[model samples]
Target chain A: MRVGVVTFPGSLDDVDARRAVTLTGGEAVSLWHASDSLQGVDAVILPGGFSYGDYLRCGAIARFSPVMAEVIKAAHAGLPVLGICNGFQVLCEAHLLPGALIRSDRRTFYCKDQDLRVESTDTVWSNAFTPGQQINIIIKHGEGNYQADAETVKMLEDENRVVFRYINGNPNGSLHDIAGITNERGNVVGLMPHPEHNVDPVTAPTRDGIGFFESLARYLGALASRTQGGTA
Target chain B: MAKIIVDVMPKPEILDPQGKAITGSLARLGYSGLSVRQGKRFEIEVDGEITPERLEQATQAADSLLANTTIENYVVRVDQ
Candidate 1:
């Protein structure tokens, strides 16, 4: 499997995301923010960072990048896209996912190994974990507070589209403690935490993030089966 | 030439941490019975005579990029 990791001009975590992709048995392909091509990778990732220096609002400028046009198009065609941290903000700005991330309620950045519960396993990004499983991932951001309309929240809850929720404590005052969510198609997933930062035991706080990368293989396999008319 | 201004403010329902911090500072400095909400202002210069079409375009820009309608509200008007 090949995973494309897109690097925006101000992205700081693209290298780590590429490494995590390779470490999880997938070939890592470096995708550029201006190239306007996906390079035919099976899946794509938008790594965390202060894209475009958080100008205007986080991920607002980056959404207009040339590469994002292709990403947005492919995402609609069922391309598996995983957006982490500021990447999540980009997805929201791009309208690929609902909700917007606002400044932290604490008026300062919060960085820690945060606990999150896997609320759903139907998405391609969370299928490796059981329902309601708890895992620790690195959460570092100044604008991780998630906000959405009440009706949107109700619909997400009713549809089981919420993939992850903050546990132990609400770090950024996110509504309903939502830390992550997936599109209705289950191919696009966005989260405020940085799973790429904790994929290695030697240089990270926990290895719990490997599951997110590993799940890609399982999802692809299931898709292959479905194409072959084997009940997936 | 004319100036088109776009003012953006956090939605009333959304928390404005920056604005709240500014309020705290005002209180610390002995300001009483006053509240403040921080927002952004953009000034766009138009070279030609301001017309109805240009005003509509400015409003569209405010809606499309100058403001995020999800958590913010924006107003577009002529500055000069």
Candidate 2:
């Protein structure tokens, strides 16, 4: 499967996302922010970074990018999209996902290892992990606080859309200790932690994050099999 | 040219760490009984007359680009 990684002007983690994708049995395609074409890739990832120098809001300007327009469209059409950190902010800004990320309530940047419990395995990104499984990953960001209205939070809870919940301690004062979440359809997943950084044994703390990439391959395999089974 | 000003602030329900930091600093400086919240202001110059339609345009701009309505409240008005 070909997974496209869109690089915005100030995106710093595209390379790492691409590496993680490649390591998990997918071809990584380089996508540009100015381009609207998705290169017919099976999946897309808006990696973490200070896009547009984080001007105006974390992901405000980047949300207006051409690639983002297409990504948003594709995501609504059921194409799996993963947004990490700044990417998550972009997803919220783009309205592909619910809620918004704000400056950490602690009034400080957080850069440390965080344990996240997998709350939902229905998304293409998290199907590899068992329910309630906890995985350690690196989280490094200044604005990782997630917020939304009471009704929306209630809906997310009722719908089982919360994909990841922070364990041990809430690093950034996210409501309900929410570190990540998915859409109703579970096609789009956004999170504050850096799963891309935890995918390799040589460079990362553990391979805990490889499940996110491996899950995509497994999902595609299941899809291809279903199609074949239908024809046969 | 008509200038439009957009003022944006964090929503009351949302926590404002930066604003709290400012308030804490103010307290440290002996500014008693004072609370502070931080926000942003944007000034945009329209090329033509400031009609009602132009005001609507500024409002839409504020909604789409100038501010994130999820955590912020913004007011767009023609600068007098």
Candidate 3:
């Protein structure tokens, strides 16, 4: 399976995301933010970083990049997309996902290996884990707090769109201690933690992060085979 | 001309430590009954020639760029 990792100006985690893809037995393609094409990759991952220096707002300017135009379209067409940390910010900014990320209540940058519960495993990116599984991933950000209105929050809970939740403690003040979410179709996933950084056991807080990439590979590989059979 | 107002706030589920700290400070200062939640507001001026589509585009721009949706909520209104 081939996965594309988009690199926007100021994106810090693109390399790590690509490495994670490669380690998971998939081809990692480099995509530029200024490019309009997706390079025909089966899936896409928007890595984290202070895109556009987080000047106007985190992930704000990055959302307007040319690549996002294609990403938004492909995502709607059932392409799997995963946004991590600042990537999550960009997803929300681009309206692919709902809610917002704000500064933490601590009002300071947070950095730690976070424990999270895999609340929903139905998403393509999270299918490797069972519901209620505990995983450790790194999180680093200043404005990682997630928020939404009462009605919207209720809807997310009711629809089981809430994908991940803080297991140990609220690291960034996310609503309902939400650490991640998936779109209604379960194809697009966004999370505040850095699973890419945790794919390697030597560097990861734990080996749990590999499940995310492995899951995506397995799903996309199956999808590719299905397409081939249909064509035959 | 059209006037647009934008209001932004942290989602209620997310904890607002900054707002709480401010509330604490206010209580210390003897402003006992004051309630505060931190957020942002923007007032924009639009030309009368702007179409509703264009207005919506501008609002989306404001939402995507000017506002942080992860921790903020925005409401837009156009005043005649």
Two-chain DockQ for each candidate model: 0.87, 0.91, 0.51
The digit string of per-residue lDDT tens for model 2 on A30-124 reads 99999999999999999999999999999999999999989988998999999999999999999988899999999789999899999999999
Model 2 complex DockQ against the native: 0.91
TM-score on alpha carbons, each prediction: 0.97, 0.98, 0.83
The per-model lDDT (C-alpha) reads 0.93, 0.93, 0.86
List model 1 lDDT by residue over B1-80, tens digit each: 58999999999988999988989999999996778888999999998988889999999988878899988999988886
Report the TM-score of chain B alone for all candidates: 0.94, 0.92, 0.76
lDDT of 2: 0.93
For model 3, residues A26-108, the per-residue Cα lDDT tens digits are: 89999999999999998999999989898767888888899999999999999999999999998988889888787887788
Error of 2 at B27 (Å): 1.3
Docking class of 1: high
Name the lDDT value of residue A127 in candidate 3.
92
Q: Model 2 off-target regions past 4 Å?
A: none
Rate residue B44 of model 2 by lDDT.
92
lDDT for position A30 in model 3: 100
Candidate with best DockQ: 2
Q: Estimate the TM-score for candidate 1.
A: 0.97
